[model samples]
Target: MSSEEAAPLLCAGIATFNALKKSGAEAGDMVVVQGIGGLGHLALQYARKMGFRVVAVGRGADIAEDALRLGAHVYIDSNKEDAVARLQSLGGARAIVTMISDIEAIAALMGALAPQGRLVLLGAGKNPLPVSAGYLVRGERSILGSITGTPFENERALDFSVLAGVRPRLETVPLERAAEAVARMKSGQATFRMVLTMTEKSHARP
Candidate 1:
């Protein structure tokens, strides 16, 4: 893998990998990835490769195709359909891994989890997460936060990526254009990830 490929694995890759590991979801179980952007995209690939039935939930129809291409068995458009209802209809998710930080939005997804299922959080929002006791007590569903891994775990994530052919979809920009890249990322215009390369010219690849 080139630097562009390896770069994301170190950050987004490890984060998602660790989140999945902590999710308590087994192979053949249903796992939902919400957000379908930088972190969620990689999570879908990892979950599929790990043998989970992957479900992707995103806000637009535009992302549906890419979500499927990235290894999701089902893509739920949150804009047009009720994501919680759709997920519940599928027998609920064994684990729902999300990078979205909207606490209200996160609260809404709790209903989609199967009994004892977990909602693994990878995004950090400013406000407190408003979770009702009934949601946790009645179904035994739980929420947890996950961050990047240690050096050894990072190596493991990389090794797994290589063995499973998992790679981040990336757009590379010259180091000189880093500010432009940052601007695009901040504006949510970046397709997924933007890598700044020291090379004179930069390119994009799958």
Candidate 2:
């Protein structure tokens, strides 16, 4: 997608960038990123640019190389290795930013946080995250939900996107094929963000 295509960035891009900026994780701090799709992809780049040591976690080995290419210092396949244990071995993560809606996935990563570390939830989900009281009290860890950012934050996200070359990988389809694009996303077949283009028909219509 072109630089002018800012729709996806306004939503997913700023959401992840703002979460990382507010996470209190500094340069060289280990930050765990959950999921490898839309938001997670952008989060990896932003976290790296923010100077955090990024560990990208996903379901399978399929995305391992892709995550690394996206600036992850390490890639963890949750299906193969215990994500919490893996993070613990690395001295725990300063923050875990999740872009997937799976409650259990979120709960699993909560245990992998360093003391006082934060778990930022950016994905929408209906299920409850089952975190124990002792986990929160012992480490002073926290769980937070993030929505889209303000106009200023959005502008910052855009500026960073240009400065850091943090562009979203997108698949563009004609406006008439919007439904097909949605289906691709729903089926987990879309490797990146999907954008719909305005056709000549669109301009000619009301």
Candidate 3:
């Protein structure tokens, strides 16, 4: 559990990201993680703490800056630059931890991955992945289907998030603003997370 009632925003995100970290990251590895928002940004921080050289791909410079501040070695503005080639230039990545399942994005990242590397899917989109068999065969690469964080992992995520000050830059909205917060998250506009706060007494949630 998180420290504050509003903290579930980052709490949920930290959970998923850590699972990806545990699955594919190692000390001193080059990592090109895709999608730097919501759960994606938390993944960047976890990657950095794991001693990986992280390259975060996303649309906003603020998100990039936040990633860098959180320990990412570099941040690629996917909007202005070629996302695939940008990741490609990073050489062999141990794994591609992605939250974007767009047809082209998935294809590009899979192709750019290193031999024996893994490409884990973390997106919540309903769109089916458009991948070619060649992408998986060439490098002996693997794809992983990861689920949301577990209670055990969530506990660890909270500890790490609190100790490391891995604050997910967020805009806390009241219950009334819940719709707006959801919209922001849905539109890919929420920087790191969208917290919906309640005015209930402290320790309100049992």
lDDT of 2 by residue, 1-206 (tens): 35425778998999999999878799999998999898888899999988999999999999998899998999999899898998999999999999889998888788889999999998889988898989899999988888789999999999998898887777777788888889988998786787778752211110
Best model per TM-score: 1
Compose the digit string of candidate 3's lDDT tens values, residues 13-97: 5555565575566887777778766667677777776678888877767666677876679888877887667667777778878
Tens-digit lDDT track of model 1 for 71-182: 9999998889999999999999999999998888888887899999999999999999888889789999898999999999999999999999999998999999999999
Specify the highest-lDDT model's number.
1
Q: Give the TM-score comparing model 3 with the true structure, all chains together.
A: 0.80
Query: lDDT: which is higher, 2 or 3?
Result: 2
Off by over 4 Å in 1: none
lDDT for model 1, please. Answer: 0.93
Q: Over the full model, what C-alpha lDDT does candidate 2 score relative to the true structure?
A: 0.86
Q: Per model, how many backbone clashes are there?
A: 0, 0, 0
Error of 1 at 30 (Å): 0.6
